[model samples]
Target: MKADYKNWMPKGMVTGTGCGTIASLVLFLILGVSPIVPEGSAKKVIGIVLLILTVIFCASTIWMYLMYRAFSYNGKRQMSKQIIEGVASYVSIPDGGKGLDVGCGSGALTIACAKKNPGASFTGIDRWGKEYASFSKKLCESNSEAEGVSNTSFMQGDACKLPFEDETFDAVTSNYVYHNIPSSDRQAILLETLRTLKKGGTFVIHDIMSKVKYGDMQAFVQKLKNMGYDDVKLIDTTSGMFMNKWESTWMGLSGSAILLGRK
Candidate 1:
């Protein structure tokens, strides 16, 4: 069976918008075509309003469809695969080394990194909350089994407070996760992910680290360097690495970037 890594754009948004669009169109036509409200009345104003709403919904549906296609596995853009492989490339481990994937929805990153380093073991953890009903621990496990990857495991856990001890894994990585967490101190969450990394280990965390969501990320990089991390750098993935500027802006992902280096 093909692994179903759900889209970044939630299904409800598109479906709800499409439904609103159709409903408004039907109401507008009924008000205008039927002689129920008579000419030049308040009903005409309501019909005009509904017509404008239909236009907005139509545009939203088209935009969402394009974005869904871009993020899909078989998409022309394939942004998800590119970003997963890109993050996995940084997860190099020696034979018998262990790795961790925080917020591993659908196990895409964990599976990709596991495939890249067959000799190492990988663990993926997520709360599998109701906000994302499609992603779960079982789904991650099944995807690994389907890919014939025996060295990976999945569990339910929190990103804010990882279940592992400090300096446990040889490598740690996450993609587009931390920002989604509802916390005023998002930097602390980043540090929590880093806390599980062994000294001299590597980390690659990608997310919408816009200044609004994460304040002064460059300063955070400097802080990591001052704290003795080596070669810590923040890279803008929207510069054609995973997506271009236009695509990022179009998809409401303007601040997408990858933070990588050794601890």
Candidate 2:
């Protein structure tokens, strides 16, 4: 059975936008061909505006499709796979030790990490909210089974308040998760994830991490260093790890980076 790591670009958005673009173009054509409106200055202006709207909608639809293709596992770019593999690389769980994956949609990263550390086990958790209704706990488990990753399990949980005790895991990681959460303090959410890692435990959390969404991440990294966390560094993925600067900017992931280190 092939695992389905759904595209980051929602299918509904692409289809809906494509339909609107088609409708706009059809209306423009009908109006131009048939004298549906009187030949006047106002009609001419309306036609121009309608044609502009059609162009805008058409462009949006094309962009969404391109993003979907890039993010798809079967597509040429396989961007999600690159990001997942990058995050999984930092996860090092000792034999008999456990690791945790927050917001583990599809469990792709969790499975990758688990397969890499066969001596250890992993738990993947997510809210499984309506926005990504298809990414349920069952889907994660099924993906693991299909991928032959028996060391991993999954459950539904809130990222803001993980159910496990403090310093419970050997390692912790997440990918492109926290930025989507509507938190006034995204740093707090990062801290929440870090709160569950054992002393000397490694972590890798990837996200858009723009100044507008995360605010002064440099200061936050300094705070972690001050608190004595080891090897704390933020690496820019857009510089070429997962995507280029131009791709990140066009895809609205301009500040994408990986925050990695040990607790």
Candidate 3:
């Protein structure tokens, strides 16, 4: 995509950097006795202008930093709260349930579930795509440790061909991962996830359907239902706080929907 240079930079940083650079250049003129600001009252006016610009730059930088913190950590951001909720809802551990998080970037969802379900053990598997530096495996491990969740472990694995025994996990969750897969291989990934789930277990798939015709969603839902899933539910709860929490462009194009079923 082409860059929108003006708005592309966060307002705070842009204003700060632009103002600071201009101010520094102007300051040099003042010190060097350049003709730009001749020695009289004009120098005062230029100094005030520089001061105002400096303030703008500082404020903008702070605003940009706050925005970054709310959405993501390091460089990876949270998925929409609605999608997180959808995944969490399907992840059940009555006393104890073995859990698997496929495509678990940064281990945010994995760690959270592990903390909440103290009785359950959670495993997060991800290839840690290189789109962002925050997707590093070390970051996930550190995040898990920081959250103080011992039951969660991070591992690198292929989503389309998971390395696990069939019926290994009581609950499985995937968030916005399948859409990135080659369309032909998405089903294979879904089947692999299904294979690892125990009978009567819950599975949650949260992803965007903007690229395909609406009919395609119906067919996909039907396919899951045909696979012996007890109930298939689609829900759109992506708005407000949930929308602002993620950097995903999919949230902007269309809200996320959760496809949940039982094996």
Best-to-worst lDDT order: 1, 2, 3
lDDT of each: 0.91, 0.91, 0.67
Pairs in clash, predicted candidate 3 = 12-60, 16-57
Q: For candidate 2, what is the lDDT? A: 0.91
After TM-score superposition, the amount by which residue 175's alpha carbon in candidate 3 deviates from its true location, in angstroms, is: 1.4
TM-score of 1: 0.93
Q: lDDT tens digits, residues 1-263, model 3?
A: 21111111234554556667667656745643566656777676776766666566666556555554444322344333334554685577766788999988777678767876889999999897554334656767777777676898889998988999999998888877777676654555677888999998888777665435233666767888887788877765455434532543522436456767888
Q: For model 1, where is the 10-residue window of minimal lDDT?
A: 32-41
> lDDT per residue, candidate 2, 133-178, as tens digits?
7788888888888898899989889999999999999899899999
Higher-ranked by lDDT: 2 or 3: 2
Candidate 3 TM-score, C-alpha based? 0.65
On residues 1-263, what C-alpha lDDT tens digit does candidate 1 reach at each position?
87777777767777878898899888888886578768786877887788898899899999988888888887788888899999899889988999999999999999999999999999999998887888988889889988889999999999999999999999999999988899898999999999999998999999999999999999999999999999899999999999989999999999999999999
For model 3 the local lDDT of residue 254 reads 67
Model 2, C-alpha of 232: deviation from truth (Å) = 0.5
Error of model 3, residue 174, in angstroms = 1.3
